[model samples]
Structure formats: C-alpha cells, structure tokens
Target chain A: MGEFELIRRYFLPLAGQGKSRSLILGPGDDCAIQRIPAGRDLVFSVDTLVEGVHFPKYYRPDYLGWRALAAAASDLAAMGADPECFTLALTLPAADEQWLAGFAEGLRAASDAFGLALAGGDTTSGPLTLTLQVHGTVDEGTAIRRTGARPGDLVAVSGTLGDAGAALEYLAEPAPTPDMAAMLDRYHRPRPRLELGRSVRGFASAAIDVSDGLLADLGHILQASGVGASLDSARLPVSPSLARLKGDASVAHALRSGDDYELCLTFPEDRWGAMPESVKRQLSVIGVIQAEAGLYLDGTDCSAGGTPSGFDHFRGKG
Target chain B: MGEFELIRRYFLPLAGQGKSRSLILGPGDDCAIQRIPAGRDLVFSVDTLVEGVHFPKYYRPDYLGWRALAAAASDLAAMGADPECFTLALTLPAADEQWLAGFAEGLRAASDAFGLALAGGDTTSGPLTLTLQVHGTVDEGTAIRRTGARPGDLVAVSGTLGDAGAALEYLAEPAPTPDMAAMLDRYHRPRPRLELGRSVRGFASAAIDVSDGLLADLGHILQASGVGASLDSARLPVSPSLARLKGDASVAHALRSGDDYELCLTFPEDRWGAMPESVKRQLSVIGVIQAEAGLYLDGTDCSAGGTPSGFDHFRGKG
Candidate 1:
C-alpha cells in the first residue's frame, strides 16, 4: 500500500470518538484544523524519537507509539495546556503490517487516554524515526512557564522518580528479572500528569516536565527563572521499587537518570498550603527556590551537574 | 553545549522580530504559546526530512533549512491559512557550528519571508534529521479543503509546474548544468503561495499543494471531493526553461514529477471571472472537474496512469 493509504487505514481511524470541540477538522486534510477558545492561548511542542539513539530496535511498536505520544503530551502538561490535537511525522525503513497494527493500537490508546484527537501527519521512507507535534490550549495567562519561578518558592515534583531509568537498566541487564515488570511498565507507558498539571495551574508559579534527570530539568527552571534551588536529597520521592533495588547509587540514579515524565514545579509556600489534599499528596516538596541561581545538592553545589556526558545530538555524545 | 543550550544559542535567536500579536510566548518554555484571533481556526502540519531519504548527505544546511520550512508552510497554503509560527525538532549526529549557522540563516530567512515566529521544540541525539511543525490560522469556515472540490469547477494551478522535478533530476546528474540554475533554485527554495492562497479563499472551491506531482496531488482533491478532472495536457503551465528542454518527455515530466510546490485549485467558471487579472494571469486553468471520479488527460484516461510508482515511504520502493 502507499504511504497515504497506510496513514488513512492505520492512523486516521485511530482518532478518538469523543473529540474536543477544539478539533475543528481532525484528519484527512493537508493540515489538521483546530479551534481554540477565543481567549485561550494555543501551546505546542514537537519531539522526535529516533531508533538506536532514543531507543533500541528491540522496542515493541506499541510501546514506542505510547511513549511517543506521552512524551509529547508531557510538554503540554508542563504548560498546563489541555491536549487538543497532534500530528505524527513517521519515517520508517519499511512497513510491516504487524508493527503498524501494534503502533496504531497504542496511538489510539494514547489518544483516548489523553482526550485528544489524532490529527493529520506525513509518512515517508527513511530510517525509523517518529516525531510528534502536540497542540493544546491554556486559559489566557494561565500557562506555567519555566521563567515564572521566584525566590523562596517551594520546589515540588509529581509522582516517584527514577523508575524509568531503572527499567532501562533492567532491560540492559542479562536475563532481566520478572520482579522489574512494574518498572518496565513505567518505562514503556508513562501516564502524563495532564489533569494534575491543569489542577495546579493557579498554584504553580513555575513548572517543567521531568524528561531529563530531576536535577537537570530543575536546573532549567532555575536558569530560566534566574533563581536557584536547594534540593534536600533525602526529600526526593524515590519509588519504593527503585529504593528497594539498589543502595546509594539508586539515589544518584533518581537524581541524574531521566525518562521520569513527571512534572517538577514551584509554588509559593502560602499558595502551596491551600492546594487540595490529593494534589498536595501527588506533589512532593523536594526543594526550595533560592536567590542564588544554581542547583544545590545537600550542602554542596551540584549546579552544572548530572550526567555531564551529554545526550544531546549535537554534543559530544553524538 | 547541551541540546537545550544549543537550541538557545543557535535556533532561538532566529525567531522573527516583531512577532505576530498571536505569539504570546516563543521558545525556552516547554511549549510555545500563541493566541489566535477570536474567530480564526488553527491549522498545523509536520514534515520530516531525513539525511539520506529527503536529500543527499552533501546538500547545504541552508537549503535544507529553507526547504524544511517551505515544505511545511505549503500545507498552510493548501488550507488557505496565514502563517503563524513553527517549531523545529532537529536531530543531528553531532553539532557542527558552521552547519548550525548556515541552517539558522536559512530558517531565519524563511521565517522573515513568511512572517512567522519560531516556537518551541525539542532536540536529542540521532542521525541527522529535521522535523518541522508549522502552524497557521484561517478564519472560521474560510479555510479551503480538498473535500471542497466540486464537479464542473475549473481546475487551475498557480505558477509554473514541474520545475522542482527538473531541478531534482539536474542535481542527480554527475555534472549539473549551471544553465538550469533557476530549476535548481525551485528545488532548493520553494516559495509557498501564502498570499495567493488567501486571495483565492472565497473564489476557489478547493485547493491542494502540488508536492507529489500534479496528477497525484490533484488525485487527492478528486478523491476527497468525489469528483473527476479533465486535464488539458497542452494547457498545463510549463516554464519556458522546461518547455525548451527535451520535448514530449519534458511535458510528461511536468505531469508526473514531484516537488513542484505549486498550488492546484478549483473554482466555478463564474467565480474565475471575478478574480483579479494579475491573479488570473498567474493561475493557469488546465482542466475542468468532471462528473466521473477519475483523472483524464487530454481526452485520454490517466486515472491510474500518470505514474504507477508511488513516491511515499510505505510502497514497494521502500
């Protein structure tokens, strides 16, 4: 089949049944048309996952599909934007019906889970790569920006950290144990904190989704906001599974390992106190914003830290 | 530098100055935020260019940048939407300062020419790849759609056709002829007909950007609208340069060559008369919509005849 037909059959029908009114015209057009509310601001971000670099070739298509959407939507979560639509630019070496089926299923599952529509996309012949562009809408002036952090604000993170990193490690291990199934799930299917992000909009002064390690992502907020964060290593939320697995090294993993897909945010102490109990439970205060613009670990400064071996394409790693 | 820093130093500064009022916030945030005019609907499309698949490895970074932006913007033109903003998810094997500079220059040129801002995007390590997501806005109910084509409407195209294809052929030759410089330019820097698209909004019943050859692209409109087209091979606009080249084969190439980046649209005969003379002069009326849902060429049926081969990723070629 041709590339366009493959999209119509495998991807277009994957659009969720209950689409937001915001998706004016979902798929089947040159461009996906969407209508944001009059006063709302449209927020968008694009992420690309390349084979061998971003993930190994052994990954299941379904998991890759789910990961692609979740990763892209995490940006929306950071901005407190509701997912409206997304376009996929998929480049594959070859088309396998089985792989396509698995991918389409996972994509459909993601669309339904995120309450978004599968918009139009382009598919071409090339090395396996997937790029997703996610679009969402935020109420006027309500989006969380990395530059909104202020000194004295308490720094918080949603959910546990380092599980995905652990999962990656487990996968790399010979004869990986079944006990790490939950961690593997975390790596495969990250549930983006969309609802929590929206709920904390009025509360969070600054926010970012943790794709990079906790310290690395937090540093972004600090640098952008021209503030600093004092992180109490002991206060970091380490998943029980991750905590039970390794020793002090696990803490380092939580601090420096990536793929958490959780939101790290800052809020003024007073406003943080007024947040709903459930919201508060989900958000673990791990640090405090400081006047000095650097990342502090324990008492020492770990600013300009965390896996200094860069994962950037244009950097030394590449 | 890290991926994020590279984007900041090299890409972020390329955002056009005096951004559209719609752009509330640009790069640096997890997601770029933009505010659309009250009644305008947002339209977006994503296109990926792989190192070997989209272009030769030896191609210039500047040309790649321009091509990426222009190819994506062409989708906006097809929808008759005005350019707003675009995000680049660029992956590379390694950072080349010189390549980055040239690429940024081309991106800046395209952004300034099209009047759009550089929104947010993500970057990571991988083989050289570029994914561009372009966003535009069209007033509610004003955006043209392929499905809007009607039988009995006159089919027309903006600018000359098949120049890009000739250029691609020229480039593939061992010693490319400098005399075909104009064709090379078409292949290198396609100008998306944004203004012409907007101007034809109310007059044209349907439209599509000519990328995968005129016949294949027009086939999309025909299929979407459940109409047919009777194309006069002689009436099709052929550039003087293309016409002067290899006779019958050149015209055949005009019909079947991809990457033209022209706008093929349909309009009622009555409405065509109302179009500005300059616009009419630019548009070559090459065909009439037929009751039968297939394409005909100079009284000969070319329904599945133009080119049996598909240029898309999934077909036999891949």
Candidate 2:
C-alpha cells in the first residue's frame, strides 16, 4: 500500500476513537486545529522510541505502540495536565499491513485510555522509529513544576517501581509465572498516572515522572528546585514481583533502571495529612526535601560518588 | 557528551534565541508550558526527515536543520497561523559535536526568522532522523481549510516555483554559475510564505502548502472542497533560474516538483482585486476553481491518466 493508503487503512480509524473536545480538525489537512479552553496552559513534550535501542527489533507492534504513547504521555502526567491531543511521526523500514494494523490497534487503545485525540503527524520511510508529541492543558499557574519543591516537603511516589526493569529478564521467555506475567504486562503497558496527577495539581509542590529511574528523576527535581532530598532506603516502594527477584538487585533496579512511568511528587508535609484517603492510599512517602545540596540515602551522600545516573542515550546503555 | 549535556550545550541556546510570549517554560522540564491566547485556535503539523531518504546521506547538518524546520513550519503558514513553538525529536547514530553545533546554528537562525520558540523534545540513539511538530495560533474560526474553496474562486500560488526541483541535478556540483547557485540556495532554504498566507486569511477560501508538487497538493483542496480546477499552463509561475533550464522539462518540474514550500491559495475572483500591492506582487493567479469535478490543465482533464501523483514514501521513489 502507498503511504496514504496505509494511513487510511490503519491510522485514520485511530484518530476517531478518542476525539478531544479541544480538537477541531483531526487529520487529512495541512494542519490540525484545536481550541485551548480559556484559562488553561498548554503542556507539550516529544519522545522518540528507536528500534534496537528503545525496543527490540522484533518487538510486537501492538505492545510497541502502547508503550511508545504511554511513555510520552507520562510527561504530561508529570505536569498535572489534562490529556488533550497528540501526534505521531512514525518512520518505518517498510509498510507492513499486519504490523500497521496491530500498531494502530494499540495506539487506538492508548488514545482512548489517555483521552488524547490524534491530531496530526507524518509517516516516512527509514529505520524503524516512532516520535510521539503530546499536548495537554493545565489550569493557569497550577502546573506542578520541578522548581517548586521546598525544604520540609515530603517526597512521595505513586505505585510501585522496578517491575518494568525486572520484566526485561523474562521478555523472550515463552512461558512465565503469574508474577512474571504481571511484570511483563507492566513493561509492555505502563499506565500514565493522569488522574493522580490531576488530583494533586494544587497540592503537589513539585512533580516528575520516574522515567529515568527514581534517583536520577528525583535528582532533577532537587537540582531544579535548588533543594536536596533524603530517602529512607527501607521505605522505597517495590512491587511484590520485583521483591521476589534478587533483593539488592531489584532495589537497584528501582533506584537506577528507567521506564517506571510512576509520578514522584513533593509537597508540604501538612498536605499529606489533608489528602483524601483514597488518594493517600496509592502513595508511599519515601523521602523528604531538605535544605542540603545533595541526595542522601540512609545518611550517606549518593549525589556524586557511586551515583547511579539514569539512562543517557549518548553516554549510557541503550 | 550525554544526551542532556548535548541538549543543554546546543539546543538550549536555540531555545533562548526565540522565546515566544506564549511560552511559560521551555527546555529543562519534563514538558514545556505555553499559554494559548484566549479566543484563538492552535494549529499543529509534524514532518519527518530521514537520512538517505529526504536528502543525501552526507548532506550538510546545518542545511538539514533549516530545511526540516522550514518544511514543517510551512503547514502552519498554509493555515494562516502565527508561528509559535515547535518540538524536535531528533535521533542520531552518534553525538558529533561539530555536526550538532552546525545543526543548532541553522535551527537557531530559522527559529529567529520564523518566530518559533524551541519547546521540549527528546534525543535518542539511532540512524539520523528529525521529526518536528510545530504549533501555531490562528484566530478562532479563521483558519484556512482545504474544504472552503468555492466554484468561482481564483487559484493562486505565492512565489516562483520549480527552482528547488531544477537545482537537484546540480547538487553535487561544488562550483556553479550564479544562477545555479541561486537555484541551489532555493532548494536548501525555501522560505515559507507566512506573510502572504496571513495577509489572505479572511479572503482566501482555501489554502495549502505546495510541498508535494502543485498538482498533488491542489488536488487535495479540490477533493476536499468537492470542486474542480482549471489551470492555464502558460500562467504557471517559474523562477528565472528554473526557466533557464531545458524548457519542457523545467515546465514539467514547475508542475510536478515538491519542496517549493510555497503557499497555494483559492479566493473569490473579486477578492483578488482587493489584495494590497505588497501581497499581490508575491502571487500568481494560475487557475480558477470550477464546478466540474476534475483537474483540467488548459481545458484538458488530467486528473487520472498520465497524471504525476507526486511523492509517496511507501510506493514512490524516496
């Protein structure tokens, strides 16, 4: 099929699945038009997933589609923004009808889940890669920023971490236990914490998605806010599946491995008490913001020496 | 350098150069925040350029940067929107400092020229590819769409065309005559007709950017508007440098070439008389929209047989 035919057959249906109220024009035009509701700020982010680097060459198209959109949408979740619209600029080695169908199905599922309308994009011929740019909206001055953390703020994380990183071990395994299956699902279909992000908008002083591992991502908040943090190693949230792995190694994964997609937020200590019980139940207070200038783990400075920096595409493992 | 360091050193500077008023936060955040002006609609488009596909394998990085952005931005211009911000998702096999510096320089120059702010994006490891998603603003209900053309509308195009196509033959010729150099420049740096597009906003019934050849793009407008068009072959505008090429083939290029980055518009016949001289000087009225349901070139229906359908990534020669 030609490019237009491919889009019409597979991707065009995805555009109709979850039409955002903001979206005026969807596809088949020079540009997509969207109206930003009054008093809302637009939040934008782009992420690229490359074959063999971000995912295996033969990764399932459906899972790859879900993972790519979920990962990009996590940035908007970090900002406490309402999901609005997204664009996918996909470059593939060839146009495979079956693969396109699977990918589009997965994308449609995510678009519906995230409430992001498919606005516009491009499809090209090249080495397999997917670049997703997501746009969302947040009420004015309510966007949670990395620079908002202050001393005495409690640092909390939503959901457990390390499951996706732990799942990497069983990816090619044909059969797995229930725990392993859950971890694999976590890796393949990580959900963005959109509702939690929206709920914590005015309450959370700072927020970030834990994409580059806990230590690296939280370090960003600290560095940007000009504050520091001290984490109780024992309090770090870990999934039951990940806890069954080699204990220290699984903890290490939680701290150093990326793609968790959970929100790490900091807010005044008093706000924790004020949060509704339903909201508080999903969070674990793992650390506290401090006046000090470095990350501390169990009273030891881990900011420089022996630091496990997050995945850096240029300098670290792909 | 790591991906963050590379972005900070090169891309960060580009963000500082053209800070759009709507931009609240740019790079260094998980997502950039922008305030959309009240009562305006956001216009979006994305384009991807890949190595060995969109351009030569060892094309100049600086020129690639400029061309990629200009190509994407042209869609916004076609919508008659004011350029606001863009996110670039760039993947490269390696982090070469010199190449990055040159690319950033070119991107910065275009950012200033087009009044676009660098927002947030991702850098990854892969075969070199650039995907730019641009966002612009247009007055509510005023965006020019492909469905708006009426039967009696005058079909117009901005600037002379085919210089870029004619220049392709001499791409590898290092030393060239002044005319060849000019054509080469046109290929490398085709300007988006933003001013002309904006000036014709309320008057122009429909508009499209001529990126995939004039006929192919105009066909989009015709198909969407449920209208036909008749072109005067002799009235098609050709650049002086392109006209100097072999006559018949040059005219073919003018009709079938892509990458012109010029605006093709349709407006009522009487609206053409009201256009200011400044805007009129940049346009050529080459055709008229007709009630008949097919494309006609000098009264000859050329919509189907022997038609040049322009570039398609999957079925065409990319």
Candidate 3:
C-alpha cells in the first residue's frame, strides 16, 4: 500500500477520538494545529526506543508499540498534565503488513488507555525504532516540577517497582520459569499512572515518572530540587513476581531497574495522610526528601551517591 | 560519559538560548513547558531520519544533524507557522563523543539559522536515528494548509528544484567531477524556508514543503484541497547544476526525484505582482491550481489520473 493509504487506514481512525479542546486540527494536514487554553501551559516530551537496545528483537510487535507509547506518555503523567496528543516517528527496515498491523494495534490500545490521540507522525524506512513526542496541557503555574521537592517532603511511588526490570532480565536470558513470563509481561506493558498523577498534582510537591528505576529516577527530583533523599531499603516495594525471580536481590533490582513507568512523587509530610484514596491504595511511601546533599539507604549512605544511575544513552546499562 | 553528562555538554547549551516567547520552560526538567499565545494556534510536525534509509550511512555527522532538523522544520514552513521550538529523539548504537560533538554542532547551526531553540529531547541506544518534533505558532485562521487550495489559484514554488535529487545520484555513484561534489552538498544540506513561510502566510492559499519531489509533494496539496493542477514542464526551475546533471531528462528528475525541501504554494493569480521582490527572485511560477479533478502535464493527463509519479516509501528507489 502507498504511504498515504497506510496512514489513512492505520492512523486516521486512531486520531479521530482525540477530544482535546486544544486540538483544532489533528493529522491529515501539512501540520497539526492545537490551541492551548488561555490559562494552561503545554508540556512536551520525546522518547525513542530501539529494537535491540530498549527491547529484545524477538518481542511481539504489539507489545513494543504499547510499551513505546506508554514510555513517552509516562512523561506527561509525571508532569501532572492531561494527556492530549502524540506524534509517532517510526522507522523500519521495510514495510511489513503483518508487523504494521500488530504495531498499530498496540499503539491504538495504548492511545485508548491514556486518552491520547495520534496527531501526526512520519513513517520512514530504516532500522526498527519508534520515537514518540507527547504533548499535554496543564494549568499555568500549577504543573508540578522536579525542582519543587523540598526538605522533609515524603517521597512516594505509585505501584510496585522492579517488575519491569526483572522482566527485562527474563527476556534477555529466559529460564523455564512461569513467573518469569509474568515479569516479562509487566516489562512489556507498563501502565502509565495518569490518574494517579492527576489526583496527586496539588498534593505532591514534585513529581517524575519512574522510568530509569526508582533510585535513579527519584535522584532527578533530588538533584533538580537541590535536596537529598533517605530511602528505606526494607521498605522497597518489589513485586511478587520479581521476588520469585531474584529473591533477596529483588531489592537491588527494584531500586535500580528502570522502565517501571510509575510516578514517583513528593508531598509535604502534613498532606501525606490527605492523599487521595486512589493514590493511597496504589502508592507506598518509599522514602523522604532530606535536607542534606546525598542519598541514604536505611540511614546509611547508598554507594551510588544519590546521582541518577539510570539507563545512560552513551554509556549503556548504567 | 553518561547520558546526562553528554546532554549537559552538548545539548544544554542549545536549550539555554530562549528564542521563542512560547518557551515557558526549557530543558533540564522532566519535560519542557511552553505557552501558546492566547489567540494563536500551535502547528506541530514530526520527521525521522534513519541511517542508511534517508541518507548514506557514511554521510557526515554534522550534515546529517542539519538535514534531520531541516527536514522537520520544513513541515512547519509548509504550514506557514513561525518556527518555535523542537524536541529531538536520537538513537545510536553507542555513545561516541566525536559523533556527538559533530551532531551537536550541526544541530546548533540549524537551530540558530532558523531562530529556533532546542527545547528538550531523548537520547538512547539503537541504530542511528534522529526524530524531531517541531512546534510553530500561527495566528488563528492564518495558518496555511494543504486543504485550502481552490481552483484558479496560481501555483508557485520557492527556490529551484532537483538539486537535491541530483545530489542523491552523486552520493549513490560518485563521479570524478567537481559538480558531483556540489550536488552531494545540496543533498546533505537543505535550507528550510522559514522566513518565506512567515512572509507568505497571508498571501498563499495553501502550501506544502517539497520533500518527496515537486510533483509528489504538490500532489498532496491537490488531494487535500480537492483540486487539480496543470504544470508547464517547461517552466520548472532547475538549478544550473541540476540542468547540467539532467542533460535531457531534467523535468523528469525534478518531478520524480525526492529530497528537495522547497515550498510549493498556491496563491491568487492577481497577487503575483504584489509578491515581495525577494520572493520573486527566489521563487518561480510553475503551474496553476485548476478546476479540473486531476493533474495535467503540459495539457496532457499524467498517470494515476494526473498524479505526478513521486517517491513512494514502500516502493524504494523507483
């Protein structure tokens, strides 16, 4: 099929459901047009996932599509913004109809899950890579930033961590283990905490998505907010599936494994009890924002020194 | 160096230059924040260039960087929006400091040339790919669109075509000729017409950037606007260098060969005399938007019912 026909068949239908008031025009134009509300600011983020680097080459096309969109959308959730629209730039070595169908299905599923519509994107011939740029809208001056975390703020995380990391390990070196299969699924289908983000916006002093593991991602808030953190290693929330895989080492994996797509937020100590029930049920108070300059693990300093040791682009497997 | 350090060294400087009022917050956060002017609409477009697909694998890193940004910025220019900010998603096999330096230099050159600032971006490991999502601003109802052309409008083109196509030929099979060097340069470094887009916003009825050759790109305008076009093949503006390369089939290459990043526009016939002298010098009258339902080549119907044979992504290297 021709590029135009492919776009119309696969993308236009997906774009039809975008209900953002800001979207004056979506797709099928020289450019998509959006009108940011008078009192709102536009939040933008871009993320790219490669076939062999970010995911295993043997992974399902549908899962890759879902995970890619979820990864980018998580940034919007991190910023306390309502998901609006996304543009996908997909590069593949060739046009394979079956692969395209599966990938599009996955993208459609994630778009529906997050209430984001595909606005515009480019499809080109190249290596397998999916780059998504997500745009969101938040009330002006009300959007939570990483720089807002203050000393004594309670650092919390929505959902258990380390599951995705364990999944990655399982995918890299699969064993005849049923629990490994479940962990792989969690890694492949990360659920962006959009609802939790929206609910905790006002209550959270600062927020960021846990993409590059809990410790590494939270370190961004600490560094940006010019504060420190003291995370209780005993309080780390490792998923049951991950515990089955790594046993005691699950604590390290939960702290350092990336791609969780959960929100790590900070709230004032006084407001921790007032956190929405929805957030309360899903979130765990993992640590507290500190007054000092480094990270502490169970009252002892962690060797990594609080600097984000997440996935490094140039230096792989950080 | 790690991802953060690489970004800090190469990209942060680019983001520090706040060129647009829309940029409410720049890089170094979870996401960038922007404020679309109250009465204006945001124009968005994304383009991705993959190694060995869009350009030769051995192409200069700096040129690749410049070309990638130019290709995306061209979309905004086609829509007649003032360039704002862009987010880049880059993937590479490994982190090479030398490559990063060259890429950043090229990116900085293009950003400064277009008066755009780097807002934010993602860096990851994968086969080399650069995906850029550009945002622009246009006053309400003033943005040019491919769907706005009507019958009887004069078709115009900004700058000469076919130079880039000729450059591609030179890259694929280098000749022991100095002109071949010039052609390759044209192929690698396309200058997006940002100023001309802003200048012609009020005058042009519809517009599109010529990426997939003149005929193919212009066909998009025809299809979207529900109109047809009649081109005088004799009137196509080919560069002296391209004319030399074409020898006999100059018109064919100009029409079918892609990679030319010029602006193809439709304007009222009467506005020709009122056009700016600068535009007149750089642009030429190539055809007219017609009342008929299909395209014509020198009064004769072309294949696919008047659609010019342009590059197809699925059917490569036709």
Candidate 4:
C-alpha cells in the first residue's frame, strides 16, 4: 500500500477515538489546529528513538510503539502539564502491513492511557525511527521547572527506579518466570507519572523525569537550580524484582542505568510534609538539597569513586 | 561530544535570538511553554527528512538544514497560520562539529527568516535523520481548509512550480552557468509562501501547499473537497531557469515534480477578482474547480496516460 493508504488503514483509525476538545482539527490536515483555553499555557517537547540505538533490533512492534509514546509523554509529566495531543513522525524501512497493525494497536492503547489525542503525523521511508512531539497544557505560572529547586529542599522520586534497567536482561528471554515477565513489562511499558506530576506541581520546587539514570537526571535539576543533592544509597527505591537479584549491581542500575520514566522532584520540607497522605505515599525521599554544589552519597562525593554516570547516546553505555 | 553538550553548544544558542513573545520558556526545559492569545488557534505539523531517502547523501549541511525547516514550515503556510516556533529532532551517525556548525547556521537563518523560535527537541546517535515540528497560530475560524472548495472556484498557484525538480540535474555540476546556479538555489532554498497564504485566507475557498507536485497536491484538494479540476497545461508558470530547458520535460517537471512549496488555492471567481492587485500579481490562474469526479488536462483524463502521480517516499521517485 502507498503511504496514504497505510495511514488510512492503520494510523488514521487511531485518531478517531478519545480526542481532546482542544483539538479542533486532527489527522488528515496539512496542520492540526488546537484551541487552548484562555488561562492555560501550551507545553510541548519532541523525542526521537532510533531502532538499534534506543531499542533492540528484534522487538515487538506493539511494545515499541507503547515505549516510544510513554517516553515522550514523560516530558509533559515532568512539566506538570495536562496531556492533550501528539504528532508522530515515523520512518520505516518498508510498508509492513502486520507490523503497522501491531504498532497502531500499541499507539492507540498508549494514547488512550495518557489521554493524549493523535493529532497528526508524517510517515516516510528510512531505517526504523520514530519521533513523537507531545503537546499539553498547564495553568499559567503553574508548570514545574528544573530551575526552581533551592538549597534545603527535600529531594524525592516517584515509584521504583531500577525496574527498567533490570528488565533489559530479559528482553529476549523465552518462557520466563513471573518475576522475569514483570521485569520485562517494566522495560516494555514504563508508565509516565502524569497524575503524580500534576499533584505535586504546586508543592514541588522543581521536577524532572528519571530517564537518564537517577544521578544523571538529578544532576540536571542541580545544575539548573544551582543547588547540590545528598542522596542516601540505601534510600533509593527498588522493585521486588530488582531486590530478588540481591547484589550491588542491581543497586547500581537504580543509580546509573537509564530508561526509568519516574519523576524526580524536590520539595520544600514544609511543603513536602503538607501534601495529602495519598499523594505522599507514592514517593520515596531519597535525598536532600544542600548548600554545596556537588552530588554526594554517604558523606563522600559521588564523582570521586564508583561514579554512576548516566547513559549518553554517543558516549556508549554509562 | 555528548548529546547534552552538543545541544548546549549549538542548539541552545539558536534559542537565544528571534524568540516569539508567546514562547514562555525555550530550550533547557523539559517542555517548552507558550501562551497563545485568546481567539487564536494553534497550528502544528511534523515533517521528516532521512539522509538517502529525502536528499542526496553528499550535500551541503547548511542547505539541508534550511530545506528541512522550509519544507515543514510550508504546512503552516498552507493552513494560513503565522509562523511562531519549531522543534527539531535530529539523529546522526556521529557528532561532527563542522557539519553541525554549518547546519546550525542554516537553521538560525531560516528560524529568523520565517519568524520561528527554536523551542526544544531530541538528539540521538543513528542514521542521519531530521524531524521538524512547526507550530504557528491563526484566528480561531480563519484557517483555510482543503475541504471548502466549490465547483465554480478558480484554481490558482503562487510563483513557479518544479524548480526543485529541475535543479536535480545540477546537483553536482562542477561548474555551472548562472541559470544552473539559480536552479540549484531553487532546489536548496525553496521558499514557503507564507505572506500570500495569510492574505488569501479569507478569500480562498480552499488551499494546499504544493509539495508533491502540482497535480498530486491539487488531487489532495479535490479529494478533500469532493471536487475536480481542469487545467490548461500551457498556463503553468515556469521559472526562467526552467523555461531555458525548452522542452516537454521541463513542462512535465512543472506539472509532476514535488518539493515546490508553493501555494495552490481555490478562490470563488467573484472573490478572485476582488483580491488586492499586489496579492493577485504573484499568482497564475491555471485551472478551475469542477463538479466532475476526476482531474483533466486540456479535456484529456490525466490518469489515463500522462499520470503525474507525485512523490511517495515508499513507492520511489514519481
């Protein structure tokens, strides 16, 4: 089928359901039109994932689609923006019918789950790559930013951190145990902390998603806010699957391995305490903002030894 | 260099100048925030260009950067949306500082010329590919759509067509005449008809950017509007560089080649005559919309023999 036919059959159908009211025009237009309400500011970000670099060469299309959208949407979550719409620019080697169907299914599921409409997209021929640009809205002056953290704030992170890194080991495993499957599920369908991000917006001093490992991502918040953090090595959240591994290596994954789409936020001590019980229960206090300007763990500088540098695409594995 | 460093050195600087007022926050943030005024709607479109698939492997990085932005911006013009900001997702095999510098220069030039700010984006290690998502704004209900054309409307196209296609022959010409250089410039820097698009919005019944040849793009309007068009082949405006070719082949390029980025619009005959002289001067009246179901060229069915089927990325050169 031609590009248009491929879109009509697969991607077009994904746009018909769960559309946002702001989306005046969706797919099938030269440009998608959206009308944001008067008091809301528009927030958007673009993320691209290449096949071999971002994902395994052989993988399930549906999971790939889900992972791609979730990863992109995590940025919106980090900004405390309400999910609205997204555009996908996909480049593929060929028009594979079955692959398209599976990918569409994954995309539809994620779109519905994230409450982001499929606004518009472009498809071309090339090595497998997908670029998703997500659009969202936040009340004016309410977006959580990485530059707002201050010294003496409490640093917190939502959900477990190392599940995805552990999951990578079982990416191609066959007939895995339930624990293995759960680990793999974390890698394939990492959830973006949309609700948590929204709930913490007014209370949190600053926020960023943990995609490039805990230390690395927190380093961004530190650099932007001009504050340092002192994280307790034993305080890092780890999933039951990770704990079962029972080694310092698993703890290292939580510290340095990337692809965990959890929110790492800093809140004033009083504000963190004032949060509703239900909201506060989801996060673990891993560290505290400090006066000095460098990351620390267990009273030692992090970069001095056992450095858990985060993933850098051009620089290879962390 | 690392991805973050690359962005900091090159892309971050691009965001410092020519920023739109609506841009609340730009690069370095998890998501860029913008505040669109009430009564204006947001318009966005994404376009991707892969190395070998979209352009020749060996080409000037500056021209490539300019071409990519202009091509994506054309969609906003087609919707009669004022240019505002854009995000670029770039993937490359290696981080070549020289190539990146040239590309950044071209990008900054286009961003300034088109009045778009560099919002935010992603960079990764992979085969060279660039995906640009452009954002603009238009009056809530003033967006000229492809579905609004009427049967009696006159079809007009701005500027000349197929200069990009004609420029392909001189892609690597060792030394060329001024005409050939002009052709190369046309191919490298095809301008988007933004001003004309905005001026014709209220008057034109329907509009589309001529990217996939005049015939193919017009066919999109016909399909969307449920109308057909009849054209006089001799009426197509050919650039002086194209006219010098002096053959049916050049005429064919004007009809069937893609990447022109000109505006093809349908205006009611009465409205066509009412347009300001300055606006009308730039366009050539070449056809008329018809109730008939298929395209025709001088009373001959277009698809029957001289089928200018336009460019489809997966289906090879049209």
Which regions of candidate 1 fall more than 4 Å away from where they truly are? A172-179, A304-318, B172-179, B305-318
Q: Tell me the deviation in Å of residue B277 in model 1.
A: 1.1
Candidate 3 chain A least-lDDT 10 residues: A309-318
Docking category for candidate 2? high
Query: How large an RMSD does model 1 have?
Result: 4.1
lDDT of 1 at B99: 90
Best by lDDT: 4
Compared with the true structure, all predictions reach lDDT values of 0.83, 0.87, 0.82, 0.87
RMSD of each: 4.1, 3.4, 3.8, 3.3
| TM-score of candidate 1 against the unseen true structure | 0.94
Candidate 2 ranges beyond 4 A from true positions = A305-318, B305-307, B310-318
Can you write out model 2's per-residue Cα lDDT over B31-53, one digit (the tens) per residue?
Answer: 99888889898888999999999
Sorting all predicted structures by lDDT, with the top scorer first, yields 4, 2, 1, 3
Give the worst 10-residue stretch by lDDT in candidate 3 chain B: B309-318
TM-score of chain B of each: 0.93, 0.95, 0.93, 0.95
Model 4, A50-94: lDDT tens digits are 998999997799998899999999999999989999999999999
In candidate 3, residue B249 scores what lDDT? 67
Question: Considering every candidate listed, which one attains the maximal DockQ?
Answer: 4
